[model samples]
Target: MKRGYTAKELSGKTGMPSTVRGVKARAARENWPGQRRSHSKAIEYSLDALPTETQIAIITAQSQSRSDFSDNKQCFPAKGKSPPFAATTLNDDQRLTMGARLSFVLEIERMTAEMTQKKAIATIVALSKEHRLDLFLHDRLVVANDRSTPTSTLSERTLKRWISTYREHGEVGLAPGRRRKNLTMPLWSTDFLRCYQRPTKPSVEASYMEFCEKYTSDQPSIHQVRRFLDKLSPEARNIGRHTAQQLKALQPFRRRTTKDLMPCDVFTADGHKFDAEIINPRTGKPYRPEATTVIDVATRKVVGISIGESESSIAVIDALRNAVQHGMFALLYVDNGSGFVNDTVREIVERLGGTLTHALPYNSQARGLIERAHKTIWVNAAKKLTSYIGADMDRQAGAKAFRISRKQIRENGGTTLIPSFETFMAGIEYEIETYNNAPHRGLTKVRDPITGKRRHLSPNEAWARAISTGWQAIIAPSDVLNDVMRPQVIRPTRRGEISWAGNKYFLDNLRDFHGADVRISYDLRDASKVWVRNLSGELIGEAHLDGNASPYMPKSMVEQAYRKREHGQIRRTLEKLRMLSDKNNHMSIVEHSSAPILDAARLAEAKRVAKALIDSEPTPFTLPPDPIAKYQLWQKLNADICNSLPLTKDEALWHSSYQTNMEFAAMRRMFEHIES
Candidate 1:
């Protein structure tokens, strides 16, 4: 016998094609033994391994066969042409059940191949009875008699039914159909649920009752309605019941980043009410003071702050000035507070080459950095105080125990518990200093090149670093700062003195500018001095309040004085009305009686009443002498001498008459004083 033969040799010996390609093709078509690679990397058949007779039979079979090399049993039929029935509809569990059913059916079919059908059935039943075929069962089959006990056995009828289902619809037909319930609800319940889920957020019970009244039938119980409502999502239930601001808090928002911003590039400002109470300097009452703060967005440093009774434009301006001392910022971001949105603030920002931007209404998140600072710095400091009224304080117990009213404290002489306004401000300043010196997590750590030591960056460190890098702060002059921050009013100066807020402001600088409109800027907190600015925005000089004017006068004293003068006029008018009434009564009696009853007693009584009224009237105070008035009189005289134009005969006569009338009026005033 020969060793393994190549395809060419085998083809030649079997009387097939002679060429290698033709022989290889014939060998492949015949499903012959596979070829193996030899040591020389040439293809060789292993037909020589088989017996000579067997090889001859294989060659004869290959030549006679007309099929392809691949086995027909290994190939699957194309889908949809002849697929396993309903296989696509079965899930994994159902498929496993169906597979087990098919396995058992196949076992029965195999057993029946060599036996009678009735005998096969009986054999399967016998095997099931002996528990030999239990492994092929879908699951543990329940026993019919004991219902609680489970066994791995199926009835003969069930086996027959499995076989029948397989024959009709393949494996999928063995899967149990899904069971469904015939659920029904009242019509009113459906309507109520519909209304309940709407964005209007109608009350569950109310909606249910309304549905019942409208439909007049099939109303479900209120408890049932509540149960349905409980099934709804909380977010859905709160839809229209919550405000837009509350909804915004629940919605997703993008966090802002200041990574690209440099120190002094932007600053955010906001006002916070200090959580603890301090004694008001002016009122001596314990009250929460408003703290206006400006924080650099990049460094998270409190650059400027002002403590005031309320948040006002002046407080905001003071904060800006403080922040500007460190460095002039490029932009200012603030909320839509009246203080932040005014013209003075806007002008100051523009003058410093910066822009002021207001955050969206009710959107504190836009200024979240500064808002967080308020809690981190001010609120934390407040927590240490006994007068803290923060939300974290216990309302029922802690508040009642710790919170003391201003009146109660004053009456009880309890000054030990509350700090004065100055002390509170000093505490705030210390907190700010500590905050600026503390390491900020938002700042990047840097290693000192000279010391080779790592240092955590703080607000103060960042500010210093920025300044060393050539950043310059645009600081306003002290005079300009005082002028711009204070409120300004255009008032004409008379006699080198301008009356403002019930006080006269006089300056030698205004001597030459009498009757000229000048801008007077005065601080709200201090009325001792006012700045006099020319029309061109130049600071001419400072004017001092009159020595007689009270230093502690209120800012609204101008309006108060006007009100007092009007009240005095009203009293005088009332007195004159009484006198006129008495005179009118006497004249009416005189006209009706033919004889004028000018009784001496009546005249004396009337005269006494008139003298008492005159004496009761308040005496007017003397105004201080004005040098500007004398200067104006001298200027008028000088102008008259320089005039060369001759007056007409009628003008000269009128001038003489005007002079004679002035002389006569002066003589009459002298005579009247002498008589009195």
Candidate 2:
């Protein structure tokens, strides 16, 4: 055989690293057994001249022969180092004969080069047409009819087996094995067999096993049966993780379809558990509150929700409001929780634009969309929580222990608890936003028939559409109470002061009726603000709860007393000043100065009256020559310009043009001067 060419020769031909294995595969597949050259002018290399693994394999096979003997005596010593015969006894003729034989073999090899080259050329054409000659190492043959389904998960060993199977039998050999028969076991009807069989589903051997003793009077040995089962096909005897996977793969495909529900035509709202803490209403403490949430059926987006300590109708109402704020819905699908069935809640739903419906009484899957979103929000919030070390030291420390473990998920990426509610809410918002925009896997990239987008319209967007369709109805704040809220009557306390449950409230306008009767109506859900009305149903005022009576009073009482105190203080101060002035100045001040000292009290009153008069009809009013004079004395004074107060040039002009009170005109000119 010819010695193979070096790595450089292969590089010159194929520009690929020369490997003995590659050479062998080429020699075997291309039928290039020895040094050979065929279309010499072509780009192809002479395989016979190239080094190959087959040559190396042949050499390795003849290793024992090389180790056993050598014609040259000096080359290797005998087992016994000193030979008994003289070294010269070895003849040149015998060596020459051996050399001639080797030469003859080499000459024969050289002569067959053309024939081998021709044969190799023939083989190459045939192989190229019939077989791809595709060879792979430790790798897999992943086959899938659909590209969307992953084909990369195939294992190396499995692939090698598949390749071998394919080589022997072609495409038919690559078929997945049939379902295992032994794994099916056997089923026999017996007296107890009926007990294990479900009302629905198959009656399997395992299900009937319990009755074996009673019906057969003896149970078959499971081990023996298993051995018998092992005699079946390889698939039948297979055990462990792979068998389970195969069983699942064998199952017929099932499809889940969503109904083409209208926007707000149906809604799903429910509360789900979250490993989170919010203020507990019953205890007035923090605990993991149920996250009440609702979703729009058409958009498949969260519409309304509330995070609170309880899942009462109040919470449901809050979530409903959230959904309602965007638009009205026709039907509300909810879990069969006590809160949903409550009369108060039903009334609220009916009063609004929606009617309540229960999700499959006991099965939660009916409302899977919203329930799933609740879980998503919970998980997303928890994930965000892990990184949030809150400002509250105590909560921060507590949250470290509350961290979510990703291992618990059937899938990956669970959220951990964070200390800050604000941060948690922000994360929730981001998640919802992303979820709404993301293209659903089932929808592919096809445009929605309704909105012409891969994603369904978001709640707000869908609501906008509904509004265009004349489905939007405004539920005023007052109507909201009767529509979706529980009402509570807040009657005035015995003191004619209303008590908003535990908090006190008063009507500033009803000061005289402080000890009389009044009634107020407010949503029982939130006791913070109430509507004050008389015995009749007319709304008179709005008042907030009084929590503290500091500053020696409630807001209403304090404001009242402050006004009275202010007025009295001003009256007394002005009276004192006016009395001093009355005694010191002209005795003609007798009328009102004697009436009161007339400090800032009387001056402010007079100013206010004058301002009102000027604002209303100012034309008819006539001022005295000197407005400061006593009224009786002024009545007798002349209406002549001589008796009137003196005016500046501008004032004189204004007085002449407009009907004027000389004193008042002087006041206007004075004001104008001050402004300038």
Candidate 3:
């Protein structure tokens, strides 16, 4: 209906640029349909004659340039204000795409403010057709890279839909809806997932088949089922299928922070069976020795280590003794093995003014630092040895490779490729020294504030730094160390002596403790001495082995000796009984069949025979009265005899023979001597 409008009339109606020359330039740039004459002629432009895109562009530019329509305060209608669409409606990348689309639409709205509703819609459509609005979605939307194919531009309908959404719920409403595939899981899907998540851990095809058997309808493809399972987090997928320990191994763990700890604050101890075989000192056989190591948590430094035939409470105590040499620690962290939970270890910790803590059962991960050290120091060193038995080694192959016969070794000059136990221990020691001196990633690099020198420290350096900063080691005295390190047993003292391990240890201080129970701490290797402490842990005194008791003898030997003595006594008693029985039998037989006169004569004959038998033997000479006085008189007589003369060799021999004969004759002539 409106064929033409003058520039001033159009400017007054739509609030566009007021000057005709400026309007002419804008229309020309947008390629709007218009007629221009000479300077004297009036230029006329028709609204219906212009192209749709150019008309919309001109209207949009005019609307945006006006001051009255610049603000966005009055865009929404007033009922209850509609809430903005949530970002949760889309995934991360989709949300970003939606945000970019909303920004584009808002810019179009700002530019097209003066256009009528229908014209603005037409302008948006025209912009979409020319691909002018598509640049705003650059990098935000995914597209095919083929340049031969036409660019995939947004549809006018889609653009209008976005505009309507932005108008309804502000910028957030432009976000796309939930993806079609993720809307709802199929009816059989839940059961299938349950099967997959069971402890038996059925495969995807297995679970799908089971689900089909149970439901008999609405079965999902195996690929679909696999996709569903793949979407779950590793932990969820493994929940019921894996053991708690296995799951924990897969999951991440928080590292312990040692910022507040000083050297000797905590010590972690663990026993590791060495990977290489060596001669067992006790058995003299090839064996894998268990080594117990104690490490300071703050420095990651190995404070002590003890290698033995096997891990035991005694071995743990020995390691603790070695660790105490470096410094006393406040806490001991160990696993719940029998060696760590014993009363001896607990008592030792208490005596050292510290606490012993056992890690959670079956959770070796808690002691990961020490475990890593085991791998670094011990396992690495073991790989160099010929008898390595690591996990990667095939069991049968490793056994064959390491097996060397005793005869073979002897033929080879009594030498074996395997290191001796002592050499193995020395190697371990060297590894520990290297580990302590090597730079550790756990320690922080720091600069000395006073010296302005930067230090990247090893474990030992860290420990030294801590010590220099006023950390004092709570070391036990030698006596106290000796007392705490040995194993303790409570035994009662008898007659001022305490018997331990078949050896009786006696001390004058034990006199007061006789018949009293005292705690005895003695080293198994040296039982010659034992430390006696009261029940209250007060040291009474050290006791040494009794003189009569052999320190080398063990309890079993002592018991054997006692049994032998009892057996000898029984044998002697039986011999005497047999001899007495024979004599009684002979007497009874002789007296059984005699008349009274004959019996009297026979008894008198028996008496005479007994007297004759008795007279045939030598009698014991009685000591003379006043033996000391007699001895003095004899000494004087002997002096007088010596002063009289010295005897010749033959004469001396004859004199000695005469003395022996007189003695023998006196014993033989007992009846004659008595009568005389």
Candidate 4:
């Protein structure tokens, strides 16, 4: 039975009468279900307080007793709408409760609510009938599976509308019928046709989006555009993994073909980093020093190589010299490493009369020929080299130890060791020679591509060509063949003495200098030798075997000097300097004018006086009257002649032959007659 309200609520609603007899008791007296306390109150105070509606509502609630509504479930379906498909029963809670995990339920239920009540039910029914429906992405359902879902399909229209709604009101569109879609306007038939005509490739889709962003001030949403594109063709759907791989594989992938490459025309030298280590005799340790090499393109050979502690200019020079042992080169290709870009390397190349060219930074393909050759060294020789257990210099040191140990074994035990620099160098030489001589599969010369016989060249042959070609090219004169290739060494002097190899010469008596200035004539081809001469054409010394030559000075520096001296430009420069010095009073000269002046004004006047003196007849030094006095005496007589005298060669020659001779003869006769 319904529980009756207490007196407090009864008094508040009805009046004192209703409070006295509890609303339930009043209801009973009023012929109501005294079960409804409110009905009793309404009758008790019909005029001032309780209304008829209030009484009716209270009685109605009380009439349906708690026993009659024993079950908590209501008559309406649990969540307002029935589940899709046949009536089903699952004791799952649709509404949220305290302490419940609501994340999954809220998301799924929200998705379900977003669907049109009819369409949402239809999707649920479809999903129930066909458990394999995979297109219920987020809140949208896939209508048709097999027959291409045309853009006209309601589901497509619904999705397009839903996306529009989502953009306008955010995720609120996912909360059932609160969504509104964009209005679709008719586009021109031509534009519609052109849109579908686009290539169905995914790249095209990406490029189209990129184009839109670039050309259109307002870019459309990519998700919407992608869905729109989905209606175009089956090919626009997606690309398969196998298809992508096939496209990538279709491109030629064989190591770049360098068949047309020839020897000496292009050469590459680089420092190769190695994974393994070699023995160093000096420190008794093993280290993997850089392997610097210069290879010939035509011969496919390692022309010059220097396995040094580092790739230094000296090392590069040494390697180049080795390559050019047989011939000179026209062009040298290299990378942009510090060792390659430095002045030292540039000087070396320029001095040798060779032009150095650099590959694009990070572009190894430009030097593919030599780069390919280096691969063999790693694969064939390096891989075979027993792992070096000691420091880079260990082999030499160990060898020494072995030698000493051998001797020690003879005397005492086999524990003695000898670590020396010479020993290490020798061991290095041995290893290098063995590796170079070992035949390589790639290096072996087979029949020429044209001849189609056995290989035509070997690595050694290529190497030999590197030296030979470089030598031949470099041996010519720089003017004729422009061979400026050479190396230089700097040597100190004792008393203004410079040495090359061993012998020393004094610069005091050198022909090119009065005292200590030693003039060296550089050789273009063989830069190692320079001629030393003095200012008086006397050879103070020949630099062939001189130890005074400086090795520190670059070959290019020496070559420049040689070239300048060869063309006599150096002498010209010196003369110009001297003239400038004299003009500035840094040098002194004797004054030839009648008077010398120190002041600027007086100096100008003195110059005019000197000019007048020069124009006058030369005076006899001994007994004749002073030229100035004689000029005063003869002024009248000579004035006319002086005025008419010619200044040019032709005019002077004409007067000297006839007119001047006649005048002089007449003067001589007149003087004779006067004297007589």
lDDT of each: 0.67, 0.50, 0.69, 0.47
TM-score of each: 0.47, 0.39, 0.57, 0.30
Best by TM-score: 3
Candidate 4 lDDT by residue in tens digits, 1-676: 2234444435424233535456556645664432324534433233223446655544553344222223322111221222222212211221111102122122223455455434543553455355533433321222211123522122434333333333223333223321223434323322333443444533545555545645434454556555555554343233231254333334444464445555556677887755345544234454556667787655555667765566676567767767776456667888887668889889777877779998876456556666665666643444433342234436775465445545754674222132122323334444445445654455545566676776545566555654675533334344422122223333334455565433354444333333354445443224344656543434455555344456788889999989878668534444444455468886565667543225676445544554574567554432122323322334433454678753445333433443222223334444566779
Select the stronger candidate by TM-score from 3 and 4. Answer: 3
Better of 1 and 2 by TM-score: 1
- Candidate order by decreasing TM-score: 3, 1, 2, 4
RMSD of 2: 26.5
Order of models, best lDDT first: 3, 1, 2, 4
Residue pairs clashing, model 3: none
**Model 3, 455-474: lDDT tens per residue?**
65789889888879887887
Clashes of each: 0, 15, 0, 80
Candidate 2 residue 205 Cα shift, in angstroms, is 15
Q: Quantify how close model 3 is to the true structure by its C-alpha RMSD in Å.
A: 26.4
